[model samples]
Target: MRSFTGWTCLSNPSTNHLASLASAWLLWAMMATSLLAQPPLHVDGRRGPYHDHGRHGGPSGEFDLVEPTGAVTGRISLRRDQLIYRHGDGRQVVYRRNGRYDTPDGQFLGYYNTLLARVLKFPRSGFGHFLYADLDDFTPFPQASYRLLHPVGAGPIGGPIVGPWAGGYMTHDISVYGGGLGLPWLAPAPAFGWGMNAGPLGPMPFAPFPLNPLPLSPIPLNPGPVPIDTRRVALPDLPPAKIRFTNSSQRDVNVTLSDARQAGLSKTFRLGPAETHDMKLRRDAGHEWVETYELLSPDGQWITREVRHSIQPQPRYEIVVHEWRVQSVAIDRTARGNNRIEDINMQGKGIGRFLLPPGPELTDQTIDVFQSARAMQNQGTVTPLISDEQIQEQFRPSDRVSPFERALLQQQRAIQQAQQGQR
Candidate 1:
C-alpha cells in the first residue's frame, strides 16, 4: 500500500497532496457515521429496572417477556392448566408444568436454575442443553438466542458457577415465583429464598424434624383433691341474742316470731322486697332459750319455717330469701401444652344431607296459649297439647286472594293442564 507521504511526493505534488487529504477526511467521516449508528453499550452489567413488568425485571411474576433488546416482544399468559407463550410475530408456544415445553421446531425439556438465574433447555436431538442467561435488556443479543452447550459437559456449560447475578433471582424488590424462562427449578431453593415447583419431581413435601420431635403428652397440672374438715367444740351458755331477717323475694312476706317460754305469744311483721327487720331477745329462763321463726306470703301461705336453740349470749344471725336459684357445672378436657398433629375431617357435602329436615317429627307439637294457661292453673305439672281440629282450623287458607296471588294461581293451573295434556 502506498503511504499518504508517498502519494504527496508524486508528480504534480500539490494537486496529489490535496487529493490524498480529501480522501483521508472522507474515510474518517464514513467510519464515525457507522459507529454512531450502532446501538448503545451496556457497561454496568446490571439489567436496567425499566424492563420490569411494573415490578421485577423478570417474567417470573409477570406475563410480559421483556427482550434483551429492550423490546417487549411477547407474553406468557395462563390458559387453564398450561402456560401460553405468545410472540409478537404471531407465533405461539405452550409450556406444561411438568417441565415439558413445545416449540415450533419440536418438543423440548426445560428447567430453570434459581441459583444461577438462567434457563437450561434440552432439545429433542441430544442430552446436552442450551443455557440462556439473564442478560441486560439493552444487550445486543436477541431474547430467544441461547448459547450452545459444550460437547463434553465442561467449563461453564454444566459446572455450577457463581457470580454477582448468582442467587439474585429477584433483580428488584419484588418477589418472583420462578427464575429465568419463567419456569420452575429442578431442586429446592436454599433458606431465605422463594420456593419454586420441582418440575417432574412435583412438590417437595414438608419433612418433620427427626431429632427433638414435638412433645405430645399432656401437662402434669391437675389440681389436688378436696379436703374434709372434722372437729367438735363445747357450746357456752349465754343470752341477749340479736337476729336480722331480710325479704329478698319479689313478693311481700310476713315474719312471725315466737318464743317457747311463752306459749300462744307471737308477733307478726310485714317485710317488703329487699326489706330488713331486727329483733332483740333478753336472757330468757337463764340462757335456756328456744326461738321459732316462720315466713309466710302476703296471702298467709307458709314459705319457710326455722327453729333455733342457742346457748350463746349475743349470737347474731342474718337471713336472706332469694326468689330464684341457679346451679351449673362445666368440665374442660382440652390438653394444654400439647403440639401433636391432628387431622380434621371436613364435611364437604354438608351434614345436612344426612340430617332429618325441620318437620313435626323433628320438632315439639305446638300447644295453644289459652289451653296451656288453663292446664297450668288446674294441673300443676301437666302440659296442654293442641287438638287436631285447632291445627286444621289454623292451616285453613282465607277465601280472599290478591291480584298478584291470583295470577300466580292461574299460571300454576295452566302449567298443570299443559302437563295433563302432554301425558
Candidate 2:
C-alpha cells in the first residue's frame, strides 16, 4: 500500500489545491447522497426510516422530486417542531409547494418554525428539513435558525441538539425553577404556559441573524433639551415706627412701636434675659391719643423695654386739655446688669385720646374707627421723618440747608396743612 503522508507531500502545490477542492466537492456530494438515501423523517409517528405513512399521508407512493436550478442553501440544526418557510429576495423565487423554482442568487431564503415542518418552500438546491415545526408570534427560539446536535445522543444520527440559546434550560426542581426561571416556571400547569407565552420571548418573531452586527452600525440615542430654573426671593415686612421716651434720669431711648392708634398701643420691649422695666405712655393732647414707650441701650445696640398705653381723658368739661408726661421712668436691672436709656425722651402734645364706654363692652363704631386708625399707623411705619429737635441738634449755623432737608420740610408742611384741613 502507498504511504498516505508521502503521497500528500509529493503532490504539486497547484495540484494539491485542486485535489482539496475536488475532495470538498466529493464530500458535499456524499452528504447529499446520504440525505437522499434516508427516507423522510416520518410524520406519521414511525420510529425509523422506511416506515409506512399513515393512511392520512397524501398520495403515499408518489414522491415529489424537486430539482435544483440554482445554488442550494439552508440553515442547519433547528428545533424539531417549528414551522418553516422560504422567501425570495431580488429576482430569485423559491420553489413553491407547486414544484417550481426560480433564482438569481438572492432569490430563495429558508425559514422554519419548531416542528420540523416545511411551511415555506425553498429552491431544490436548499435541502434539509427545518428542525422546528411551530412558529408562534411569541416564544422566540434563539437556536431555531439551525439544528445543533446534542453530544450525549446516539452519535450524530439520533437527533439535533435541543438546548437553550445561551446556557439557560428548562428544569423540574422547585429551587431551580425559583432560582433560575424565576417564579413563572414554578406556577402550576396552564398558568405556566400562559406566563411563558406572555413573557419577553413571546412577542418577537424575526430573523435570528442581525442584519448589521458590527459596532459601526450602532443604535442611535437621542437626548432632549434641558429645562430652565426659575425662582424668586421675598423680603420681610417693614420694621415698626420708633418711639422716643424720657425717664426720671433724663435719659432718652428709642422704642419700636408694634401698634399705635387712638384706641390703644401694644408694644414688645426686651429688657435683659431676666430684667424688667417700668414703661409709661401718657397723652398731652386729646382723649383719643395713645403712646408706646421703648428704652434703648447707651450704645444704641439694644432695646431694653417696650411699654404700651391708652391715654384716657380726665373727666372735666372745661376745655379738657391733656398733656403727655413722663412721671418717672425706671429700669429694672436686677436680672442681669445695670439698665440705661441712651436717647433723649420725646415730649409731644396733641396725641389723641378717646373716651371709653362705662362698661367693658366695646362699641362696634369705636372698634371700626380704632381699626382704621391702626391701619393708617401701620402704613406710616415705613415713612421716614425728622424731629424738630433732631434738625436743630444736627444743624450748624454756618451750614446751609440741604436740598433733601428742604424737600422734606416742604413735605412736612404739606402734611400739616392736610391734617389741619381734615380737622
Candidate 3:
C-alpha cells in the first residue's frame, strides 16, 4: 500500500489529498455516531434513598404481578385461598404460599417470605423463574426487593399498601414453597386479625389494631417478702437538724441521707481531708433505728470508730464514724443477684407481641392521662376484628405503585448480575 505522504505527492496531488482526507473524516464521523447510538449502561449498585421501598434492599417478593395490556389502575386484592391474577395473553395464574405446584418446565421461580429470598433468575435468562418479577416491566435480573405483606404493624408500612408494578407469571398458577430450603428463621409476626373477603381491590384482608394492646404484667423485682400493703408514701419535708461534722479521718469521705437509706438516691456531700463541715442534717426519723450501730466500709469490711451525741427528744446523739456514713439494710440475694428468671416468667413477661419503648417518659401528656395499673394491663386486650373500611385503606391509591419503580429495580438487578458474572 502506498504511504499517505507518497500518495499525496503523486499526480493530481491536491485532488487526491482532499478526497482521502474527506473519506477519513467521514469514517471517523460514522464511528462516533455509532458509539453515541448505543444505549447507556448503568450499574444500580444500590437504590437511592428516594426510592426505598422500606424493606432494606434486595428483592422481598412483596408485590403482585399482572401482564400490562393498557394500564392497571384500581384495587387489587390478594385474599387467602382465593386467586386473582392473569397473564398478558389472558391465561389465568394463581399464587400459592408455603407450598409448591406444577408449572411449565422452565418456570420454577423462587420463594419469598419474611426474609429476603435469593435472586432466582436473570431478566430473561430463559431458564428458571424470576421470583420477584413483573412481565410488562420484566426485570432482566433479580434486584433486591422486600416482603410486601408484613404482619400488621411489623413493617414500616401502614394501611392497604400497593407495590411498585404488576405483571404475570411464566406459567399458569403453579409454584413451590420450601421450608428449610434456604431459610434461616420462621418467626411469628403480630396480626390484627383477618376479615372476610371484600371482593376485588382488597390487598388488605385485616384491619390493624394495636398489637397486643394490653401491656404485659411487669416482673416483680422485690428482693424480700412484701407486706400486702408495703407501698411507701413520700416522706413529708421537715426542718433540718443542726450538726457539726468534723472529718478526723485520714482520707476524704462522702455523707448521704435517705429515707430508704439508698446511697445512690440520697444527697451527697464531699468531706475533704482534714476539713470541718458545720452543716444541717436532713432530719433522720430515727424511729426505725436498731439501737446498736454496726459500721461497714465501702467493701463491707468492719470499721472501728466511736463518736456519739444525741439531740432533741433526747437532746443528744452519736455518729461514731468521723467520716461520711450511709445506712443499708440487709437484702435478699439470689444466685443471679436477684429474682430467678423463672420467677420473672411466672409473674408474666412476653405474654404479648408488642412492648412500650424502653425508658419511661415523664411528659405531661402521659402523666396527665393515667391508666390504673389494672385498667392499663387489660386495656385493648382483645382486637376489635378487621373492618371493611380498613381493608379498603390497605391498598389505597396513595400506596398504589407505578411501573417506574420496577424499571429502576431492574437496573439495579442488571448491575448485580454483571458483578456476579465478574465474580
Best by lDDT: 1
TM-score, candidate number 2? 0.13
Residue-level lDDT tens digits of model 1 in 1-423:
111000010111223444545544543443322122111111134221122222211222123444433355665443323335567898766543234322333323343434344443333222112223343333311122322211111111111123321211111111112222222111112211122222232222333322212122211110111112212232442344454555544433334444444667756564555667766544322233332323323222334443334343221221111111111112222443122212211111100101111111222222222222223343323222222433223221121233553454456556545655665
Worst 10 residues of 2 by lDDT: 1-10
lDDT of 2 by residue, 1-423 (tens): 111000000111223444545544543443332222211222244322111323321111111221132132422222222212222232322212211211123222233323333334222112222122234535322122232211111111221212111111112111111111121111111110011122222212221122211111111111111112212222232222222222221122222333233435345332221223443233223222222222222121223332223443332111111122232223333423233321222232222233323211221221222222233434322322223555334333122333553454456556545655665
Q: Estimated TM-score per prediction?
A: 0.14, 0.13, 0.14
Off by over 4 Å in 2: 1-248, 251-254, 257-423
Report the C-alpha displacement of residue 89, candidate 1, in angstroms. Answer: 12
lDDT of 3 by residue, 1-423 (tens): 111000001111223444545544543443322122111111133211122223322222212231222132221123332223344456544443322321223222232232232222211111111234333333222232221111111211112211221011110110111112211111111221111111122122122223322222211111111111112232343456454544443333433323333434544344445565665544332222112222333222344443232322211221212121111112225533332111110001111111221111111122101122222443235222221333333322222222453344345456545655665
Model 3 spans > 4 angstroms off? 1-20, 29-86, 91-423
**Total backbone clashes of model 3?**
35
Off by over 4 Å in 1: 1-16, 33-53, 59-91, 94-423
lDDT of 3: 0.25
